[model samples]
Target chain A: MGIISKGEWIAKDIQYRIFEQPGKFDQILSSERQLSVEYEVSRNTIRNAITILENREIIQRDGKEYRLLPTKEDFETLEIMGKQSWRTQNNVVLDTSFETNKVQSQELMQPLGTNVRKVSYIRTLADSNTPIGIETAVLPTKALDDETVANLHYQSILLFVGKQFSEAFSEEYQQVNLEHADEKMAQLLKVHRGEVVVDRHSLFVSKDNSIFVELKSSILPRFSVIVQPDQDINTKVDGFVE
Target chain B: MNNEFKAPLYIQIESLIENKIVGQEYLPGERLPGERELASTYGVNRMTVKRAINNLVSRGFLIRKQGSGTYVKSHGVGDKYYFDLAFTNEQSNAGISELLAKNGIKVSNQILGREMIVRSHFLAKKLGLSADDEIFGLHRVRNIDNEPFAVEYNYLPGSLFANAMEIDFQTIGLYDYMNSKGAQPRHVYQRIQTLRAMEKEATLLQVDKGDWLYLIQYQSADQEGRLVEYTESFLNPEKVNLKFTVVKPSI
Candidate 1:
């Protein structure tokens, strides 16, 4: 690309801000005024830049405030793949060998509503020969009724539920956090009390609205999240040793 | 607004200034408000403002001299990140060189090999060159703290980057100079994978042969959507980590 023209540069900056800070337009300068000032350029230049963002569905001008347009499900899927790749690159691991004391039915709050069922296989992921994540996945008996689903291993849960039984798994949601591992979790992961670790609770669902599986991956806190707008990523793989 | 993660303060400050430029609050060629004034306005120390402005200067965002006041520099073709790091170094104690510095990484460049060969059918299509046309192959190793972290091999159509042989392998960022010469990167695509390091890579990264590594191959294109640069980054499994944020529908 040639040198960025004053107008184009201004536009790119606005687009980046809108993506980075979802709803700061009111407190910050509008893309329009910003373009006029910096480039000694026209408001239309800013509008054109914003138009491109609108086309991508990153943001929508709502009354006076520009609201962020939520990304489609593919973003989360790609994001997980990236994180898993990074952790593998870093060689951090989670030990998933902790045995379960009991397998019982329990009720938990879910987005769709309250659901009750037996959850199984509390697992952990490890890196550098140390555990970094602990996961206790709950599955509704109805969802796991088939013998095939029941016999599946931890690694094949998403695949069996997604590709084989239900519709193709294409959507995911995740909450990332940095905090100390709780006592129980700390014991399972074998980390010191109050040590910071990366926590990512992710859920994958099918187009038919079935909850395929949930994965909770943890890592050492030195990692970060880098979000780039307008990129498409497919497939998911998790590992510690690259 | 800076994303409220515990990112370094200097990065936050730099982004703030970048925002002002984007907002047109600081127009091109226009002098920024005085350091004291900006410090007071931003509620930061004057030294902080100095650092920020110095970074802008190195980034081609601002121009300065010993006696004369600072002014915005016009965008010129050159390594943008190189100048960016130069300016960033002026402000914060660590500077933009933080990426490599924090990891205690040092780079040693060796032109492993170079050759002129005909472009393959696949490569020819990507570079807009004839399938049988000649291109230069440049291979180099990047070391971190005396250990190799990545080996890069590049293919360039000889017609482009003709003075390619003159590149000071030990110094200078390729893209920065290309940008100055009017080569800018407008888009990039990348694919990442996890694999075991081979004997050659194991020797370079100083790890066992069976150890793992992250492989990233990326292609960058110009504004006209023409392919310009292709790169491969092989990361040592022990030293580096990657981060990516995924967004999707709420369902």
Candidate 2:
């Protein structure tokens, strides 16, 4: 979270661009020559920053180009959520980075101590760069392929699942509630401990009613989020009140 | 209808009857099936059905006719109806009033102001009208058990809904007025995000300055695709749930 070195700040700036303007930001990082001119820094400084970004997994060198890796951003996937026009697509969260681990979760409705893949990230508002929340997605390893788990850091998780395992999930459940951010949540979201935030829990269910993945998000309560159920809304009543 | 988000039996019943009314399956002023009959239809206890009907009545979505039967109110469109009024059954969205009510919570609205005014350039663009055009503006607060949770500023174009401000918004719902004018919304686009409250907004919502609240922005069009309404609502995140249930795709 601290940025005392020049190379690190340049790396942070590059990170901000990809997260904020994903559509225009090509996955390939600018060449060292191009970056030095654009940032008005020497080639060594640009190279150092590129190295730092590479180490942070923000970008991966594919031959000569550094391809920007996908952060845990909701808008990274366009097939499932968001509007046709990017202007109205609502997930305005810019994530700094995401980390993953394997842990046994009793919460997943699976066997007593089944190992699950958990992905955690800090979410900042794209426009403001203000840390607004944290999100954790715990996946029950029993139901997913190992390939999907391996690509978690390199690709958009939601997008990958939609492309590969869309048929496996047919129903989703989400609930939003309010709670004060605890110490760990505050540290991750970059807010004061005890500040009020909106906590959301989501579960995706398989066709056979088995749990697939559970996602938990805690965000500062500064914006409204519009959502609707995709089925069985039962809007048939047609009369108006006098 | 995932099990994890499944509501209680009473809420399901409430949703059923409310859906019928909103779907126009039940006409205005028409009597609803008796509690006993509904209980049997939904396969639940009559007391539970009674609770559902009573909740709708208290919210002015329905009324009791003494010896006759429970009937749909005809004066104004209830908040629940706004959901159906704005979208087709298959793509329908639930309003905040219905969401809170489903949880067995009581919600009420207070109209702070209503007036006809010249539209600003911003309003003009949003409503797809000229800046000089006059429009009806309504300001209101929604309270949950008398605790203020949202402040809404809604606008309606004068071209489509003439003399709309003449109707008392406090006594009649906006959808009711829209329905009478043949301007029932058929399509709506909404976006939700958060904003820090200022002094005036904080005082209105009874929250501290700089506290974050949900800012919902909506633009709805009628059957002809004419923009009829644009609204901005600031809501307290404490009482609302942002639920998204994905339905099983039909084979």
Candidate 3:
């Protein structure tokens, strides 16, 4: 590949510096103006340098200046996607919270309703410490009562349910759509009043008894989600004997 | 051009300059042509160019000073995108074709392929089709920006369209053609997901294997509630952006 542009290199440096300082982005970037003046360079070069940092989410623009935010959940997601490439990994992040309450059932859709209540803990990707996507779970009421569920570090609810109940998942139904981040979610996402986020809502059903598991992945448009084709054929091989 | 089709002359001039700046034709901090020169180039009145420059000044794309002429803004940044409801006007079959043409992507009939397959067990379950019924399978590749972005596989009952195969697939959108043939859709059930692009997918899309791909499947129905269209598209996540709105059902 071609050499990294000077503008891009400067941007990465700013991003590292901002992430390290956290909330001191404006101070660091504004200081670069002095350096530009000394080097006899136009302020445009400094601006280009800062633009790179903003795009990386290491710093965010706040009116005429920029700010730094740090997020733990967002870091972990990037760590996984970073395996793809440095550029692909630097997508935008939104942080937010969501609540699902049980209501009357409808013809087309319904909320999770089970006597053995289950509450899934999920996290979404974040940039500069903002929530972009989240994952929540629903289990029988009894599942939430587990001590492990109460105090755990990022519990994989699917794995927990599968091992405990011998429940093998059969097929998953996913609904991908877009929606405006709600006020509460928008605040958590750290976005403007009505920014758009991609919504990936999925329903996983158990093969044995047809139990359904729902998952939602809300994200900024920058990142892409990939899934392999589902090839689960529920047939008995022994029955094919001629 | 019609008055409605043409933007205000000043607005047009303003946008033209903005596009040049954003397109990097005029780099940041580059000096724009003088007012007299620009007026002669665009064949617009000088006052129109001045108004356009003033608008650009307020829009943060240009800077003006007492002695110096107009200069492109150096700090032009932050292209904010907010998600909202899908706008029908933003969507057009012809626009897609035009973009593809501009990108030099070509489409061929590819042997006029067709297949009669069993109703998808999945679709039969979603659309209430009979388990044993057969549906027409029509598959095609849509090119975008000089590369294939999607491989569409559509399944519909043969009875739905009398000459589904005979319809023009190149010049018109399949959905629009269906509507014009009296199969106007009222609502559709859509399922979207992301999947790893496999070898077959990679070859078809001209993308590397294991690239990220988005899959969208839809079952559309008419006003009378008859199932009319079932389409599944595997697309490049980079080429197209999906936008829609979801609202809570009123109690």
Candidate 4:
């Protein structure tokens, strides 16, 4: 990564200050001279910094005063993704229904077990009750108890299983494809037949290197997936899959 | 007969042709043998060869040119460009524009509209906001040189971006504006899928109906886990190539 210039840094700091005081955002700030004096920077640097913000429309000139514009709320520190210390889990079940079936496909199982549970569900948004996507997860019955299986309806099955079995896991493989909605998918997604949709297939491996779950999700149009590879990895996968 | 492996003949034929293409035995922009010739070569019927060819065509590996034989579809590598998914900075777009400019491509945005909308159920969930909350909706057509390349729709909570509707997005990028507000995105979750252009998208993108498009959905959150913005982009598959890097664990 490249370092940002001094002017850019100063601009970001000023913007952060403005965002911190949301109640005072609309209020006119000090004069340019006063700002330059307070920041202990040269008048030219202050002017350059202010220009950066002005171009972004974070602030507008009101006569001789600069007024902060309405913008997103600020935080003291922004999280770096690859180095995230903590993750906020979305565990709330908005509104969804699930159906359980016996696993019949050998590819869905790890060792061709018969007691695998295949759960299919349609996840919907809370406010409008619009279906977001359809997900099907296959897991070994021995890995989860009856209570855990029941709770999968309200919580993410992957999270629940991870908590119960191992401390960490990674997706082994993921494949994405574009296809038209079939009759059943159209009904579930509330779209007409032949509507374009996205299909995602993932395999999750536990800490012990055992494949515990295989999940397939079909997302409606307007949703996308992004994957960032670790910098240390040798092989890089890029571009649209199909 | 290989009774143990009951794979259909058409599927096997499809893979055979697919291998040839993947292995570069049949190069892109090169014509393939006719159905009858393929059928005789593979010891399959003409109908099976036709079915296999149709499957590959639908998969974007082949193209049928009118008044000409089917040819291996060019992957459009020369015309396509790669957008970095890992970079989190103000210059990401600037860098892309500069790179494209080096290739004699001018990138510009056509601002479609900017308005305040009540948060829908889907938008509320994605942005972690309540229904009925006001949000800024910014729509733009991303043009490559003078041609439309993609159409983008971005939604930001109005509480955070109070005067967003008044700002001119054509002059500055949205991410640049957000960065100026100290709300720069540090991490993004993205999903890439394929869909056919509908009537409205077709008109906006200057493509025919049912044209395959690459749909990229992105949600960016601040370091504090607060959702900042949700964007959905419809890209012309022929013009854009979405890329990713999947890393395997060292262990």
Question: How many residue pairs clash per model?
Answer: 29, 27, 22, 13
Q: Looking at model 4, give its docking quality level.
A: incorrect
lDDT of 1: 0.48
Off by over 4 Å in 2: A1-132, A140-143, A166-171, A206-211, A220-242, B1-107, B244-251
Each model's lDDT comes to 0.48, 0.60, 0.51, 0.61
Ordered list by lDDT, greatest first: 4, 2, 3, 1
Worst 10 residues of 4 chain A by lDDT: A73-82
lDDT by residue (tens digit), candidate 4, A96-118: 22233322333442343345666
**Candidate with maximal lDDT:** 4
Q: Write the per-residue lDDT of candidate 3 for residues A1-242, one digit (tens) a residue.
A: 11223454355445545544545655667766774774355677677766645543345677766666332122222222222112111121222223333331111123434343334333432234434354455543444455646432333444445445433454444445555678866776567756666675544545544354454566654443332211111021111100
The RMSD (Cα, Å) of candidate 2 is 15.9
Against the true structure, candidate 4 reaches a TM-score of 0.39
Candidate 4 per-residue lDDT over residues B116-177, each given as its tens digit: 76625445555768768987878888888678888888888888888897788887778778
lDDT of 1 at A170: 57
lDDT of 3 by residue, B83-183 (tens): 11121111332223333332233333222245555523444433446647756667777764335667777667656665776867765666566667776
The candidates' DockQ values read 0.03, 0.17, 0.04, 0.08
Local error of candidate 4 at B161, Å? 1.7
lDDT of 2 by residue, B1-251 (tens): 56667888888899878777774445455568888999999899999999999999998889886556777776533222212212222354345554444334456888877766562544555577776998777888888768887888888898777887677765566766786888765555555555566555678899897776666666766666677787778876554434444455566
Give lDDT tens digits, candidate 1, residues A1-242. 22223443454455545444546755444557865776577888666656545533446688866666544222223333432221221121222322223121111213333342333332332244444344444444456554643443333334344445443455444444444678866776577887666555555655564454555555443222222222211111111001
* Pick by lDDT: 1 or 3, better one: 3
Judging by TM-score against the true structure, name the best candidate. Answer: 2
